[model samples]
Target: MPDKKLQLDIRIIKFQDLIGRKPDKPFGYYGLGVQYMLSGKPNMADKLFTQALNIKPGYMPAILGKLEVLLAEKKLVSAARLYQKNRDLFSGKKIYKTRVQRITGSLYSGKFFYYYLKSIRSVFVFNETIGALQRMFNADRGNPVVNLLLAMFFLKEHKENERAFILYNLCVNMEGVPDKLRWDLVKVLAKDNPDILIDEKTAALFTTIPEGAVGEPYANFILKQFILLKDTDKINQAFAEFQKNHSFPDPKTMWQYIEFCRENDIWDSTVFACCQKLIDYGWIDRTIAETIVGLKNRKIIEYTRGMDKILSLYGYI
Candidate 1:
């Protein structure tokens, strides 16, 4: 995911340039107002929206944009007043009327505004603007989107739990799936929440490998879903099929690779091949020679005799 703060700054700069170039046009001001609203700055956004409306009084985008800022600031009374004042304006066009109805709903429910800002894919401090997302979740316990949002916020706050996985999970917003949190979520699901079937959206997360990573964070997860087949032969076939696309991205060191194999009870040529590919992949920071002889762990090393043959080639005991 892109850096939200940085993306906001870039948009502000772009709109400022547009304003500089076309001060009399409402479009520039309207656009700038939107950027400010998303970054949790309702006051600045409101002023810019006003400038846009001042330039073109009938401009529907600016009209709606200003309403959004009002909503964002939780100035529901002011928003209501502004909304009713423009009631005729909304009735003037089918699209305009639809937009007005949406905004009007926000006056009575924070859920409306939450969905509103979410529809636009902008930054929204829903916790500050409307109320805590948890409150939204509490009120609308059956809403999958809100459930997902609450989980994302929890993940953002470093609160991982099985409840998140159990929710009728749609694709989680990538922004919420922090790299540090990925392993925990994956492990929790893979090890603890076996009943929670992995959704495609959740499984797609495994492919986001960070460069030069030191452990196989995603080693054997592709085969996790196969565990439900309840047949070793079918599970093995699934593993073989999965290997066609997946490679071990973690196991940053030989010891990690060895440990991974031991944990999975996978002592086979495929394991050695993956280990070789890691070295040949030229991604690890250390040379193959250093890795071969690096940090000898006798217990982990004893997992396979192939470890001895490989280490002996590098004159490592």
Candidate 2:
């Protein structure tokens, strides 16, 4: 199979071909624009979204996509203007209106105010950003977007990982929590010191992460936690779930899995098969390959590795 980057490139080309044949279809343009955005071609994405808007004015998805590109590029003025121009679409929603207002007011010269606030938070305005976010939180405690914003501030600005983790948990439990927020929560936790996150509550949080929200690298972190606790059942369960979703692991995660097997003395056929798969993918380290060879030489290992067997074990087949 082709690597992920190559597969994504092929998919993008297919989307572009479809868009070429259906020039008038807003959805086609919007879909291609999304692909471009994900592929880190924001300029192309912006133009495609613009094309989508030209074909179908007030296309909400395309409008949002364009706004995302603008925000990502730090074109705060353009983003604010775009939001203002589309006020009619968002006027009925209080949260959307508030966000628009925030964006409009946050623009200073050409940059977003958060950039400046982040710069001065530690020196001149120690508590200004946090204080403002706290007020917003007090006003709407259940708003996941507000909670996530506040959690990020605490995590990045104040280095309060515990506080951020708590807020993230709360957001995850709330209704209408975005998938991005769930993924970001895992990322923030993973970036923190592992020693600080080894407690039962944190482990529970990792285990209970919403399905489809735990990215592969994040799943590796959860696996490491299970390994640290020597919870073989949870480790196996997490690995099963991880494999169900992700077929090709990155080199770092592949190495980490090998390390986990080594530490736990798990010389099963499945472990050896996974090591061999990594070797095939050119992701296995030398030591891991040597260990797998030693395991294979010690005894006749059964060939029990396949997606069907995994799915059957998890009652998915």
Candidate 3:
């Protein structure tokens, strides 16, 4: 019997090869059309996509591909028609029903984008735009994208654990998600739930690339950001893998990380090491160093002062 993995790879390659054979078949044109569009060659993509439709009118992939191109070109009404056409062509297969559900769900999520897009149209309408996003988020509870978007909104609003809770569940169930994005979810979850335990084996999936494996760039960034959030043991493990796969950090981004650590009260030897590199680069002056130390000490002093006032008021000062 043929090796299953090799057979699968061969089938994918054959499909890829079918895309540009002479006297172009609709399947070939449609396949190459999608590939071109995703590769950012809109003109070539449009030619192939249109050719696919000409070969087989009402072909769903052809219509969807052309609509994607039209949307990128800002032809929203035309794109909407094509999107509708794609839905109408479905024959009620489970896959078709799932696609329809996902599309409708995306449109609901797009309402947030719509309001955001309009906020750019006029400064006076900015608050209305935000209100629209909030209303839609509250109204739609089943959309994973909406949940993720709301989690991001909560992070902006400083509602910490609420965001973490949504993100943790999202990562556990999501499919077709980019690895880097999954990593980011872990970072936020770890930050808000420092003492909330996670599965060590499942968590280990993120810390290192398997032998002879490479990583998605976003995946590396996710691990780096997560390492920035983790306890010493996890941080050390993540750091080793991060250094193995990526280059040294740029001075500016390093300083920004240091600033984030300080803001979140997450400072450690890694942060000091990053700061030391900045000091060596003359990016940090002694005055700035002293200011950082003073600000931290000031927060401690203010807390102490508040306690003293409370004690005095209670006759225990």
| Cα RMSD (angstroms) for every candidate in the order listed | 14.4, 12.9, 17.5
Ranking of candidates on lDDT, top first: 2, 1, 3
Tens digits of lDDT, candidate 3, 73-145: 5443344445444544643344543443343223323344555455466754554544554454466444443
Stretches off by above 4 angstroms in model 1 are 1-14, 20-27, 30-42, 49-135, 138-145, 152-184, 195-201, 205-207, 210-317
What count of clashes does model 3 give? 0
lDDT of 1 by residue, 1-317 (tens): 77989998998999999999999999999999889888878888889988988898978898888777765665543554565567667557767654544443323323544454556443554444334544544554533324434444444455545555653132232323333334444544555555433453454443333222223334333334233323345344434544545643333433344444455555555545555666455433333334333322322233435655554555644
Ordered by TM-score, highest first, the candidates read: 2, 3, 1
- Candidate 3, residue 274: Cα displacement in angstroms equals 26
TM-score of each: 0.35, 0.41, 0.37
lDDT of predicted model 3: 0.51
What are the per-model numbers of colliding residue pairs?
Answer: 4, 0, 0
* Better candidate number, 1 or 2, judged by lDDT: 2
The candidate that achieves the highest TM-score relative to the unseen native structure: 2
Off by over 4 Å in 2: 1-9, 53-71, 74-139, 158-169, 172-317
List residue ranges in candidate 3 displaced over 4 A.
1-25, 42-136, 148-168, 171-173, 194-197, 200-317
lDDT (0 to 1) per candidate:
0.53, 0.60, 0.51
Clashing residue pairs for model 2: none
lDDT of 2 by residue, 168-216 (tens): 5564433333333344555565565455344444444444333564474
Better of 1 and 3 by lDDT: 1
